[model samples]
Target: MTMGSGGSSIVVPRNFRLLEELERGEKGIGDGTVSYGIDDGDDIYMRSWTGTIIGPHNSVHENRIYQLKLFCDKDYPDKPPSVRFHSRINITCVNHETGVVEPKKFGILAKWQRGYTMEDILVQLKKEMAAPPNRKLVQPPEGTFF
Candidate 1:
């Protein structure tokens, strides 16, 4: 189903949620560490979205904006989407090769719930950045791409 058309029953609800997410982002959330939206701006289903997570203050990731991709497939809202990083960094949950966050290692994704929005995932990742093991790890040089 094409996203912009909203003609498919399969994608209708997903598109609605995505639209809500975009609007929520435009209104702005209080946290300075995260933001997200439709990747290309024209897709209504927004199956592919781009998200940014700022490094938590005082943590190794501080001052850095990590780029991420979130893919919500047909089963979305019932199942969590897949996430990958475009920016390089040291994080325990991330796969070094694929850049995909391992659900087994990443609690938020592992424990993802249908009601959770992509925003929730981004914030959870921010928390992970401040998490003990990750917080103290040496950071890669900024602007590094994976």
Candidate 2:
């Protein structure tokens, strides 16, 4: 693993960074509300991932489980992954018809940094579900997919 601290600039190679993320995903994150894993075990490049987010409480999305697809291309880490919801949702940041998360509408992906991980995206999305504008928005029927 590459380490950078203070004024130093060190970049972790793609594969090493991806392995670290994979391990963390398997371990489960805080509160167990969001999780992600490799989409295909045979994919040596680890390009695709599946993410799950349980809707936050006290919101229109509450108790709903949302599924998403994330694609980490060759420039991953340096560039944000493409994210799209497989499960239909009605949120300000997500496109209504396509289920894609529009970077222009989502600050996290639009202002992505090299250190951000798939977990960050999932966690942030969960938070978005609780945001004022999205919290009360009417959502599609449960278990419906794009």
Candidate 3:
């Protein structure tokens, strides 16, 4: 919910927000570097999703495609979704064994606000791939999955 022009509360329903995200995902995000969609078209709640990120250039992950799963529970938008990489990766913010993006280690999840979207998360992960330390780190062979 947000305060309107007259200090009135404006609330965007969860399904409405997810639907908007779905539409944007279908239309394709900028540069096609990141994208996501509903995991199951039959899911009325729109809870599970699949995200893909093309690793940033000039990094070890360059040209590599990474897949991830996102689970948005009942409180999404108000609460961040659970993100886990399906493609194996070695990043400071991701758990080595389980591939989960650790909230305490990732600023986006740690300081989540209602305004953040799934696209934001995927894009940020791509940015993380280009950032220092991670850029030069050796990665598992391509096509490997968790």
Index of the highest-TM-score prediction:
3
Per-residue CA lDDT of candidate 1, range 15-102, in tens?
Answer: 7877778899777766566988787776656789888998998789988989999999888877889999889878999988777988
Where in model 2 is the C-alpha error above 4 Å? 1-7
After superposing candidate 3, which stretches have Cα over 4 Å from the reference?
1-5
lDDT of 1: 0.84
Q: Between prediction 1 and prediction 3, which has the larger lDDT?
A: 3
Candidate 3 least-lDDT 10 residues:
1-10
Please provide, for model 2 over 1-146, each residue's C-alpha lDDT reduced to its tens digit, 9 standing for 90 to 100: 35577667777899999999999999999999899999999999999999999999999988889999999999998999999999999999999999999999999899999999999999999999999999999889998999
How close is every model to the real structure, measured as TM-score?
0.87, 0.95, 0.96
lDDT of each residue in 29-125, candidate 3, tens digit only: 9999899999999999999999999999999998999999999999998999999999999989999989999999998999999999999999989
TM-score of 3: 0.96
- Tell me which of candidates 1 and 2 scores higher on lDDT: 2
Candidate closer to the true structure by TM-score (higher is better), 1 or 3: 3
Clashing residue pairs, backbone N/CA/C < 3 A, model 1: none
